[model samples]
Target chain A: MSSFEAGAAGFVLGAACGAAGAAALALANRRRLGRFLSFAAHEINTPLTAVNMTILNFISGALGPVEKTQEPWLKMLREQAERLALIVGDLRDFIHLRLRDGLSMHSESVDLTPVLEAAVESVSWGFSQAGVAVRTRVDAGLPKVLADADRLQRVFVDILYHCRKFRDSGGIDVAAEAGLDGRIRVAFAYAGVKSSARESALALDLYYPARVRKDQLLTATGLGLGVLRLFLREQGGDLSVSNQPDGRSVITADLSAAGGGR
Target chain B: MAAKILIVDDEPAIAENLQAILSAKGYETSCAFDGSEAVAKARHEKPDLILLDVMLPKMDGFDVCRLLKSDPHGAKLKILMTTGLDRMGDVEKAFQCGASDYLIKPFGSVKLLQKVEKLLSGA
Candidate 1:
């Protein structure tokens, strides 16, 4: 065969091999992703179902007339139910965004402290029940941010949930500050780490090596972080993570100031 | 007195609908939104019957039922574990957790009322 023909033949063969490898990788990724999605849905659904059932019982007076002593428990139940509902709604929206079109951003002036406080409070009871201590350093006079409230809440909840998983009894610190160029930055810092295969599998993107235990391996379905990034980007914000020198990990979210536009 | 029943599920629409149907049949109704609250209410109200759901936040229905059954004051209250968990293991777990009866989700209004009546009548 002529040298030119031989080179062309080699090129075609290489192209075919590359295409097959790509297809195989894609298939494997899809299978892994499917399992992750199913597991996440199950984990999320269990809590949601519980919340729903509890609400039903309360409304039906199946628990009896609300007594003065039972009011605090009732309030906690309601708040937790709302929190779970919001998380479920966020997950559903994340799925829809993945399967359908791009996310559309709806920006508004939102008080960052109240939103963060509510998010923290919603999950506080569960953490306390598990013996996890939480500490907050939110700046009182932090400037408002221009962002979608729902998306921001989802991001905050995701970070808080992951932090809770790692630090059982340690404290979680959440702080916000006005950054350069009219940007508002919020950070969550957590100490210690749970080195579990199951947790590694559930870790979102921007996972820090130091944040994870040395013996722990990392795996993810990539759906949660993927949706989170999409939502942030649509809102002209950014999400990032870093392992601090103090054996702690910090996840940061930056958004434009209330009056600032990107 | 006609059986006083408490339906403890979080879904507002489901709770309201169940209350309307049960109340129409002369069953006094009360509700609680979560497992912890359900336990408190059950202790206070001492309803003759409870329609509980398995999936609940914080404590969950099984734990609530267990707590209720273990309590001297709440042991007499009949609990029907009403939930979407139709699996055999789930049903078995409900029974093991002190549920007097188990009802799967999507149960018709007629069937629900019938079951409630049967439980109330000591069947």
Candidate 2:
């Protein structure tokens, strides 16, 4: 081989090696930052949790709610604690979503019915306590899907929490069935209050605020449905939302079924 | 007799705060500042519950849990891991090692007590 050809070949190889090393270092740094953010988020929760709990114990045990002097402090403390928790939670979710972006879903043969039921059960107590009704009707014979059970459940639970924000009419209906496109489709239809139409489109975006034209502006602790949609799409599915003719917001999610367990 | 708890953590503030909260709730509590110390107390004191911390000197929380679970009398010993680690794998590992429950660090007093209450009640 000619001397010029050999040198050119070495130059190309050296450049490629340098680029690879730089990429590796960048990835390591990204991972380190993600870890640090997660740690910080957890630390934030700790003190907030302590203060809130102490106040509650004091109100319930040490000092009764009848103590007028402490009532305002307790109320204010609770409100602030809740907001802190929301901020920490949103930050945590955003970090996790970013860290997990582009990663393939961990595949397992997950039954759609049980996962849906569990998600609803996890949050139904709070919903009922707050006078919000949730009715779940999953098709009895629906096939299982190859997906991550935890993320899939979070997708629905997060949606339900979102429903809690925009649902002023007091109820949400959940149903799932096989879609025509060889997928399992889950629908969440809930009564409307004052949510803007833009929300139906933009609600999936990270930290998207659901605002009204004149009066009530509602925001939730959940990061957003966009990440959940991303999770679904990565695992052979899609998510979308629309406003019904009857003035209700209906969210539809489709997941490719596994035909049967692997 | 009130149920006894061994609070295992390296952080003094977290360990002491938890001790105060659980003690106020009418339970007898003790503290160990690391994983090896936690194991030593679990064997020595044989407390009804041990609040194990994940990150510790000598050994990590998972190893401590494994040791406790494998101890002849540790079968009935209820372990509740309290840590700042929030990964799903850690939770699964805790339960796999026979943890009665897992509480994330920086949990509020009421939440902590609730888990403690549930574990003790089950005991």
Candidate 3:
């Protein structure tokens, strides 16, 4: 072989090796950042929880008797605490969704009735505060689903919380029933707003705000519909958004029935 | 005699706060700062209930619960696992490890006492 050919071959090998090393280092750094973020999110949440619990104790008079005049201040602090927790939760979900691929889930045979009811109750105060009436109906003896109950509850909570921000709409109707195709479908139909195809697509995008019209603005929840879809998809389920001509925007989530109903 | 409770958390403030709350409710309470300490105290103290946190230094709450539950006497001890994360896997692990109940963190005193009372009453 010619000397020039040998030197060229060596140079090519060296360049390929250098590129591979750089790629590996970059991947390692990404993982390290993900771990740090996960750790930071948990550490922040722990102390915040302690603070909130202390606040609750004070408000409930577990520590001592409360004065009537101090009620308003306590109420304000409690509200702020809840807001902070929600923000932190959103951050944690974002970290999992973006940095870590997706959140981990353990699927099992889950009865969705109690989970749906709990999600509604968790966000009931928001609905009332916004003067929005939210109704939920889980058909009797609906087939049990294969899902992570806690993750499903989080999905429902995120949807309900985001829907309540549509205060200008008439109200929300939530219903869950067993489909003949061996799926459990839960639909959230938002009334009194005409949603376009573009609007529906925007709602499920990674970070876009759901805008039905120039005058109507829906506040963004950091745990976006796209993240929910990814979560559902990972568990062999699916999520969809559709618009009806009669001025209803429907968001439907479907989960597989335990044992596939066979 | 008041029912004794053991509170385990790596965070000093959380363990101290839980101890204070339980003590105020007329239950005798003790605190352990880590997983090893939690297991040792549960055996030595033999409290009626142990509020175990999932994340700890030496060992995690799940391992601690599993080890204690394996023992003849520890099988009778009621363990209520607590965690900051709402991960579904953690919930499954807690119950699988023989936890009596599980609570997510930042829980109010009302919820805490309710679970504590229910477990103590074996209802």
The model with the greatest TM-score is: 3
lDDT string for model 1 (B1-123, tens) is 778888898766566667877887888999888888898888888899999977777788889998899998666678988765212246678889989898865344566777888888888
Task: For candidate 2, list the clashing residue pairs, or say none.
Answer: A46-B106, A204-A226
Ranking by DockQ: 3, 2, 1
Q: After superposition, how far is residue A141 of candidate 3 from its true place, in Å?
A: 3.5
Query: What is candidate 2's lDDT per residue for A26-116, written digit by digit as tens?
Result: 8888878887987788778766766655565555553233477866566566555644665575566557667534343465778888888
Candidate 2 ranges beyond 4 A from true positions: A48-97, A100-154, A164-184, A190-222, A233-237, A255-262, B9-26, B55-58, B69-76, B82-85, B98-123
Which model, 1 or 2, shows the larger TM-score? 2
- Error (Å) of candidate 2 at residue A44 is 2.8
Model 2 lDDT per residue over B9-93, tens place: 8767667677877887788999998888888888999999999888777899999999989999988999998754234457777
Residue B1 in candidate 1 has what lDDT? 75
Considering the two chains of model 1, state its CAPRI-style docking category.
Answer: incorrect
Task: Residues A119-148, candidate 3: write the lDDT tens digits.
Answer: 787666656666777899988889888987
DockQ of each: 0.03, 0.30, 0.54
The per-prediction tally of clashing pairs is 29, 2, 0
Error of 2 at A114 (Å): 8.8
Chain B only, TM-score of each candidate: 0.93, 0.94, 0.96
TM-score of chain A of each: 0.62, 0.65, 0.84
C-alpha lDDT of candidate 3 relative to the true structure:
0.80
Could you give the DockQ of candidate 2? 0.30
Q: TM-scores, in order shown?
A: 0.48, 0.66, 0.83
